[model samples]
Target: MSRQAIGKANCFHDKGHHADCTLSSYPYMAAFGIIQIILSQIPNFHKLSFLSIMAAVMSFTYATIGIGLAMATVAGGKVGKTNISGTVVEVDVTATQKIWRSFQAVGDIAFAYAYATVLIEIQDTLKSSPAENKSMKRASLLGVSTTTFFYILCGCFGYAAFGNKAPGDFLTDFGFYEPFWLIDFANACIAFHLIGAYQVFAQPIFQFVEKRCNRNWPDNKFITSEYSVNVPFLGKFNISIFRLVWRTAYVVITTVVAMIFPFFNAILGLIGAASFWPLTVYFPVEMNIAQTKVKKYSPRWIGLKVLCWVCLIVSLLAAAGSIAGLISSVKTYKPFRTIHE
Candidate 1:
């Protein structure tokens, strides 16, 4: 393969750690965050039932996506020319890249939605006033700026405080040890936010799987005849034993490590930073500029390009700083020594 392809393959394979982290914990974070927020508002209600139901629904939804993707890959068969290791690496990288890209897309969507909603509210509040437009404009800008700062601050603070030792879900970890009221609140928030992230990442995979199953399996008749399975449960479930096993393994391993360390935030931070840069800063703008060029329209593409470059620079710096922090943390470790009589 070409050098670019090779580089991509290597990057993907090396990103196995990141893929594991994103697929397993990223969804959980948002779910837990939202669940906490809800519980905080409805403290007296039996919120655990709501939280459990939300988490179960979200987890199953994402898990179905994971299974479907695995099935599609299995059905499509391998690209024969690629090395097995390269392919494995590429898969790992793609999975993590998708997670990060989905995250940024969701962030942008959230900003737009919030801005529109807030602006509408402001317009109603200040209707017909001379300062209405100006006030709304200022508030919108302030809100966007402040929200961005808050996101970066929380991410950075979690990274800094935990270093490479950051937890898989910092907010959830807080819930575990914090006061009862706070823990309950945190769980509620996390559960809800997690469902959003899960849906964003999972829905596409579900659609892809559905498409592939229709194309390849076509009424599930082939599997029944070929595999000699007559049971309705097997067809209804629409998942293979292998896929289930693999996903279970993924969840089991990730949960075990996350529970054991619980404070390995620095590594998580570095991985997240690295993944975020390309997904958030590089890809979208590039795609936009490419599409604009294809349509023979130039709408301040240069400005967008510049913004992308700036984001790239910032992301690189953040990634470097995170790595340096991680290394420093490792260096600071000292082993206990015994005193002899």
Candidate 2:
């Protein structure tokens, strides 16, 4: 989704006018998705170590550039004057509207923090150790702390710089000035970062399906072994026909959905509203409460339980808002409209 968004932004940046890039993205998405599907065939998670590191470096690079740009604006007196910041907390709005907007923002934040859903799969890639959980805890604490600091800085500074004029993607909103090359480089980093990130997340789905297929099929015997094909140059590089078909289908489906619905923020809102409370908030709290087995009437238990319910209720309401937002977006939606459109 972001790749397509960036592609569209590049259209504006290069041509100084909006051009629908969705049709062009058809081939690009197909090619990239296929690359990801093929890369998923590598069973050893360690093989992705370098790519993951590169992705992290690129992510940090772009984030630092973003922060520096915002800071530059502040220092140069280019910061806009806008009263929109923190309006969600203003008393001028109706209570219901305030709650709805607040929850909507919560949904976005939850979506951004949605890595918890896949953190266990990532942890499984670690070597087995009695202290594995402790290691993961320390790693999570450090990672979260660092990322939170950057997120806060970027958000506060970007809002201060652009205020109501801020684009959904700050990098794409920059003018072609002295830092034009830097802006382009930052965008390139995002694209390359996503290429690796996609596989890391998509591999879990591939593994799940492949495992189930292996369990049910019980061998390459589901089809005649004759169904396989070998590439001549890559000696013994045999590809199972069934495996090829199944994984390719998964890639095609995902790519199609991404192309058809390129609303990145709306999709994130939906994902967060749908899964964040259950996976991130409710389950962990319940697990802690169950493990501790505090008295049901005690303050700790009661407080935790209440928090769980609040998270659940808030998630549901946020989901409703997300659905509403999606429907409204569709009313103005074009299949591949540029930002100017």
Candidate 3:
């Protein structure tokens, strides 16, 4: 029953349906599923052939790509729109409204590492700085650099461990055999992560709905009633109509894709990585260029431009490589087709 519910949730959340909401939650869920699959096959550890490991590695690479693309997209958007407001309130509200979109953009860069490196570090550093904090720039540079290193490290580890035989998705690879305690812990982590992702995407939508409701309702009852109606299955589950509806949609979409896609992990990873380049590498440089344009050009400025160009080239190459892999994977899709005749 729980599994079925999860499947339903994922179906409604996948791309082409509620893409914005899915963008935030899908990566984490996909990762969780992959891990589950790996652990399941632990008893068959000796039977874990080289081919399986290689497939797993490929999938992981794709996942990293997905994250990278997301990060790049977010950073790029921020750079492009830096001039919108000068006041703190305006900035806060604007940033909040677009937080999911930004995160989605950030996901394009390097998923876990990019978020940790660029978004988390840069945001924290900037927020901590005084108006005259000259060190903020240096700090951000160091932070992003560190992030890149970690991403490379993880990718290398995954490749070395699995090579070309890695599983297409983590869960299917492992057979979902982790101990109950560990499984419980993992499930908890997945649930919270999903919630966080949902909040990131749904906050803006919720706010918009709230405002519209307020105008139309003039009283709280109408808003409450409408909110109930908006959430479909969740409303039936006796959960908080808002949260239930939001999360249910996410879970359903992910589940559906997990079941349908032959190499779900690789596909998700590819999407993520492609998104990251623009968000992390390309956007930040562009933003720096825009921010520094008013000041006199210096060696640092020239260096930044050169760096931007390099990042752009690298990002393009990475994206191209990912697409090529996807195409190759598609060409060899004999394993996943059903034999109905």
Candidate 4:
């Protein structure tokens, strides 16, 4: 997505808005994978404070810019065609498309609000000065509320501005043009944020794999060894052969998959469907119940179980929708050749 943004901005700047600005993103994608490989050496999530802070700021900046632009478009009375519900079947949509799209929307929205996958990881870093649970509660409340508020603003305004014709990715999908520089700047911000965001998400998985390997083979020198090399200002840098190999391969594989699919929304929806319920809902809920010693089949337990069932149904529907979307995209897309050819 970040690569797409950069390519889109450059294309729009060089070619005119009306020109054929479709991008072949292989080069940019490769470039990104290489950069991620280098950034993967940043050790662990605890050391990612700078990247996390940058990602947060950039996210807010781009989101605000997108919302402002959408509102401006609506205010200027440049709104595109809109329908109260789904797009008109006779005009551009079919009944199947509508049903699938509705399902897709559910998945997309689920994915959008799914941010607690790293909740425990975050709480692990909190200071003990304040009660951890209280601080965590306050932080989660503010974070979730603010994020939802901005998300709603973005969705509502973007829809009002572009109506049924709204681009899937407003910032990079030719949705805005007149203020090309601002659009470029927003895209740049997205790239920067994603660069950091990718590491934030990937580092945990890296550590998990490395730690497991070390635990499973404590005597394997290749897997257990950590060589330190002295650096100028940063001091000694620890290099692990296993980590270097595993992380590099992981990044490469994911990069290739992204290159092959290149359908961001569908892929994201699928991932959300696969991980959201398990990582965000099931484990946490179960852990809470166990911690509080809630009796089985009691009111609280039943409520939590019902919630889990509901979320499971949602995840299943989302998975179906995402699979349908991917199939649809594959029929239209020519991997790496063009976006929608």
The prediction achieving the highest lDDT against the true structure is 4
Model 4 global lDDT (CA atoms, 0 to 1): 0.85
- Candidates, ranked, lDDT: 4, 2, 3, 1
Q: What TM-score do all the candidates reach, one by one?
A: 0.38, 0.81, 0.41, 0.94
RMSD of each: 20.3, 4.2, 18.8, 1.8
Decide which is better by lDDT, 1 or 2: 2
Write the number of the candidate with greater TM-score, choosing between 3 and 4.
4
- Using TM-score, rank the candidates from best to worst: 4, 2, 3, 1
* Over 4 Å off, model 3: 1-109, 113-172, 175-195, 198-262, 294-297, 332-341
Name the 10 consecutive residues with the lowest summed lDDT in model 2: 222-231
Across 221-249, the per-residue lDDT of candidate 3 in tens digits comes to 52353322334543322223433443345
Which candidate, 1 or 2, would have the higher TM-score against the true structure? 2
Give the number of colliding residue pairs in candidate 1. Answer: 35
Highest TM-score: give the candidate number. Answer: 4
Off by over 4 Å in 2: 1-28, 44-46, 84-102, 173-178, 219-240, 336-340
Pull out the clashing pairs in model 2: none
